[model samples]
Target: MAVMDDSRLAEELRLTIGRLVRTVRAVDTMPPGEAAVLGYLDRGGPLTTAEIAQQRGVSHQSAAKTVKGLLTQGLVRVEAHPDDGRKLLLTLTPAGHDRLAEERRRRADRLGRAINAVLTPDERKTLEAALPLLSRLSTHGTGE
Candidate 1:
């Protein structure tokens, strides 16, 4: 096979990945902002609203709006910060864990079905083989 241009490959890969994300997100049961907050809290709980805003790359008010909805839905709870009384720490509740798990399972099941329907066994293997490389590449994603 002929060698592909690196720049062209990068552009194509970026666009394709963006499209894939959009397609998968179509199955989301909740707004992406709320789901993202739930995911971050699950992975790193007891974070402050400021931290959530940083992680989300959104303004504090934007993160607050999402957190407010989660609070009303009983998916998250806020507690006074141990180190700083002025700020509140956010953590997922039991219901929040259940909801996040259900959401993940639903998305995974949909993706799994699509994969089974669309890809041949060898193609599936090839995609699986790319996962580690993709993961490694993503480690550079947060570089400033």
Candidate 2:
């Protein structure tokens, strides 16, 4: 096989991955903004609206709207911040936790099936072998 330049190969790989992600079946019941908020809370625990917005890369007003919807759904609860009386901290309720877990499981199952369909056994093994490198790339700047 001819050796390709690393940058060109990486860009091609990224485009392929992007196409795969865009084509995946998503859970349509939950809006993207709400799902993002829930995912952040699931990973980082309780946070104030400002913190959530920062984590989500969204405006404060956008985060507020997402939080309002979550509150209306009884998926999140607000409490007085111990350090700051004026700002409220938001945490996922039991219902929210359960919902996020279910969503994750569903997406994992879908992805597994899709991957199995597309790749041969050897290719799948090769992809698994590259996971560590991919993870390193993912954590390079985010301080994960």
Give model 1's TM-score versus the native structure: 0.94
Model 2 lDDT per residue over 31-95, tens place = 87887889989998889999998888899999999999999999999999999899899999999
Candidate achieving the largest lDDT: 1
- Over 4 Å off in model 1, which ranges? 141-144
Q: Write the per-residue lDDT of candidate 1 for residues 10-98, one digit (tens) a residue.
A: 89899999988887888888999999999999998789989999999999999999999999999999999999989899999999999
Give the range where candidate 1 is weakest over 10 consecutive residues by summed lDDT: 135-144
Considering only N, C-alpha and C atoms within 3 Å, which residue pairs clash in candidate 2?
A: none
| Candidate 2 vs. true structure, TM-score | 0.91
Q: Which pairs of residues collide in model 1?
A: none
Name the best candidate (by TM-score).
1
